[model samples]
Target: MDSLKVKAYGKINIGLDVMAKREDGYHEVRMVMQTVRIHDNIKVDKASSGDISITTNLGFIPTDKKNLVYKAAKLLMDEFAINCGVSIDLQKHIPVSAGMGGGSSDAAAILYAMNKLFKLGLSKKELMERGALIGADVPFCLMKGTALAEGIGENVTRIAPMPECCILIAKPGFSVSTKHVYEKLRLNEIQSHPDIDGIIDAIEEEDIYEMSSLMGNVLESVTVKEHPVIEDIKMAMIDNGALNSIMSGSGPSVFGIFDEPEEAEFAMNAIREMKLAKQIFLTEPHNVE
Candidate 1:
């Protein structure tokens, strides 16, 4: 095939807890991550001109070497000594730097597509390993589905997926800097961590309520302090019938699990009416086939 079109799925942190800060300045984390149905569209094609080009729908988004997708494609082209040029077009829907793993997922998707496009014969494990060179979240983004990410988010373990229910994603107009949140986090001041073990059990048992109730993110303590609106969004989600809600990643975005489709639709409409989020999406959990 000369070209390929793919979807890069977004993700939410079902639970996130920091264990310790490594000497490398990366934090050790244990989190439950779930993929959602929302995604961005990416198309990769060959260019006869023998030069790489990256383009995107958003005007401000860089299509240069600075972009993760560009880095991914460059990494493969350089490492594998591919002789042809490539053209990449990204149509983004996922919120940038919003803790939803949008850029990482796009990078992961690009790696997979390039592997096939060039007939590189890279295995899944090999793709994931190469993916880590771009970002810590790249490995998990390549893995997709439900998984446990530890050790700066690269060490991923596939786990039983949380039972499917209505998932509502709400992103405020602003973005949160992941680096800023990590820097502000004082491990000493943290009094609680998400019950990851319990969440795993709930997933295995298909207990949405139990899993939702157990959801938490220690990073919220930092992000919410700066954006009080983050907490406000969570409360709004809960008040409108979310079983439970929490901030995703180092986030200005908050997501909630609802009991049913009707409640979820109601909650989405209500949240939309409140003008609390710049973007609101009603979607369900996504798992690898």
Candidate 2:
């Protein structure tokens, strides 16, 4: 049996702005999400009886149809009317529900590997479109790089020559529920957005300072206040000389952006010494080698 392995890269929200809640029960969002070098490894093989089997070391994660990877494979087989079974083994290094879009990345990788293994020959655009059904961020992860996402996270606009930056991701021992975070949000609450124009300009000019200053996540307000330790993690990064720091996604994982790998490494070591979070990782941007 032939098998193929693919890298499932995690993502960081460089800038996330929650515009407003829509009638569809989802919020309108404007975000610049970049895939980082941090990743989970996935290996897929052909299965005999038209069954999907997923194995992972992370006991907390589901391996059944509830998993996004399983759903993604099912979507492709059903859509293209193909007949085959697939066995997916995931080396789940990324923390679950850590705001890094780990699950979404894995799902996207599964779709990509299956497409290639089965010789489906789907274009990148078609794969992204199909990926949208798996999750809001799955499509973006399908074509990893830098992208501006909107409209429940399905609308994607690509950005080229994204500056090289190092990432420091720190996940605390606890997890925050996305549902609870959204429910706690208040429409009338005072809100601020990252400098969208400044961020775009930074990407265009490849300016690290400008990019750092513009990195902000509106969801931080909901997560930080609930867990004071989250604020501590941000402070630790800043104190360690991170160029910019922000909480990613809806919860507990926080990332510090650095212009130099040395700076990011310093911050990672500092965070590790303090033992503030469950784990700390130093990584760089994703360009798909």
Candidate 3:
């Protein structure tokens, strides 16, 4: 195929814990990550010219080498020694820097689409390996589904899909830098860590309530401290019929789990009316087929 189109899905961390600060300056983490239906549409086509370029519907996203999509294309071209170029068009729906893995997903989409567009015939494992060289979350984004992520979000183990439920995502008008959040985190001060295995078992049993009750993120302590609105969003989610609510990833974005679609819609509408969120999405877990 000369071209390919794919959807790059976003993710939410059901449980996140920092184990220790490693010598490499990255933290050791254990987390349960689930893919959501919220996504960005990526269309990649071979270019007649010999340079990589990107066009996106979102104005704020960079179109040059600084963009992950551009990096992904460059990586593929350099590694395979291909002389041809490609153009990427990104139709973004996922909120940027909202702990939703938007950039990583975009990067993964390019890797995946380029593999097909060029007939590279790379396996999923190989694609993930290539993705890891770009970002910690790229590997997970390439293999969209529920998984247990460790080793700074690079080591991923596919797990049973999350129990069926509605996921309501709320992002305030701010972004949290992953580096800043990690810098603020004091691993030694952490008193409790989520039961990662228990969450795995909950998914196996399809127990939504138990899974919701188990949701936690140690990073919230640091991110919320910097931006108290993160806590407020979580409280609002819980107060508005969410089975459980937690901030995803670094900060500034909170997600609520609801069993029924109507309940989720009600909560989403309530939050929307409050004008607390810059963007609100009523999405659900996506299981890779």
Query: What lDDT does each candidate get?
Result: 0.92, 0.86, 0.91
Give the runs in model 1 whose Cα sits over 4 Å from its true position.
none
Between candidates 2 and 3, the TM-score winner: 3
Give me the candidate number with maximum lDDT. 1
lDDT per residue as tens, model 2, 221-258: 88898888888989999888888889988968999887
Q: Candidate 1, after superposition: displacement of residue 251 in Å?
A: 0.5
Ten residues in a row with the worst lDDT in model 1? 46-55
Model 1 clash tally?
Answer: 0
lDDT of 1 by residue, 151-206 (tens): 89998999987798889999999998999899999999998898999998999999
How do the candidates rank by lDDT, highest first?
A: 1, 3, 2
- Each candidate's clash count: 0, 0, 0
- Which 10-residue window in model 2 sums to the lowest lDDT? 187-196
Model 3 pairs whose backbones collide: none
Evaluate model 3: give its TM-score: 0.98
Q: What overall lDDT, based on C-alpha atoms, would model 2 receive against the true structure?
A: 0.86
lDDT per residue for candidate 3 within 54-171, as digits (tens), equals 8899898899989999999999899898888998899999989989899999999999988888888899999999999999999999988999999989999999999888999999
